[model samples]
Target: MITGIDHVQIAIPRGQEELARTFYGDLLGMSEIAKPAALRRRGGCWFRSGAAFLHLGVEEPFTAAAKAHPAFLVDDLDGLQSRLVEAGHECVRSDGEIEGVLRFHTYDVFGNRVEFQQLCELG
Candidate 1:
């Protein structure tokens, strides 16, 4: 009994809220939405795309992903890469068939890796 992805959560070490906002909001252009009432005091942030949501949770020390992450699909890979670089974020290349799509990864300000994807036929 499984449905599609509900949301992807990442842990952000303390003292990096500003950086997270800049990267996820100002740079990446994802809309920042308020977390649920119960999670408001947690001190992190949430961002949403069309049908996907990313929950940035606050933790003592930032932890990298072992087998989890949010893979965001974009229409323009080159243009997106350019914008990310302009925003001072580096995109790392990866090898995989992600959702039957080609994609790459970039670390959020909190050192949490986020993936950017595009269909191979479109590239």
Candidate 2:
């Protein structure tokens, strides 16, 4: 049987592990998780938010993922956007909001596109 998405990995330029930490952990507020011994030498970082996980890997001749991305749900739209900007990252507004949801997109330190969304509370 198929289950929900476990994790997603993004390719990044080599030696950009710190950048991944800054954006994914410090700025995005995800907790860093230690990679298994077999994967440690590959170079990258892994983060977790509850059961959801994401991995950023380093590679030569890295290519930016313009279309592929991982979307994160947020509680505060404006606040999160402001915080990202304060951290020196650009948050771009996405066209056509889903009914009862506010959405936006941005790029991570490795230039991978990410969608952020806030669901409207039903009264």
* Residue range 1-123, candidate 2, lDDT tens digits: 976888988888888888788888888889999999999998988999877699888877899999999888878788989998998788887635577778889888767899888887654
C-alpha TM-score for every candidate: 0.83, 0.90
Model 1 residue 120 lDDT score: 74
Q: Candidate 2, which segments miss by more than 4 Å at Cα?
A: none
Write one digit per residue (lDDT tens) for candidate 1, span 9-120.
8888766777788888888888999888998787888999788788888887667674467778888877888888887888876646554576788877766678888887
Off by over 4 Å in 1: 95-100
Indicate the worst ten consecutive residues by lDDT in candidate 2. Answer: 93-102
Candidate 2's displacement at residue 76, Å, is 1.7
Superposed on all Cα atoms, model 1 deviates from the true structure by an RMSD in Å of 2.7
Relative to the true structure, candidate 1 reaches a TM of 0.83
In terms of lDDT, which candidate is strongest? Answer: 2
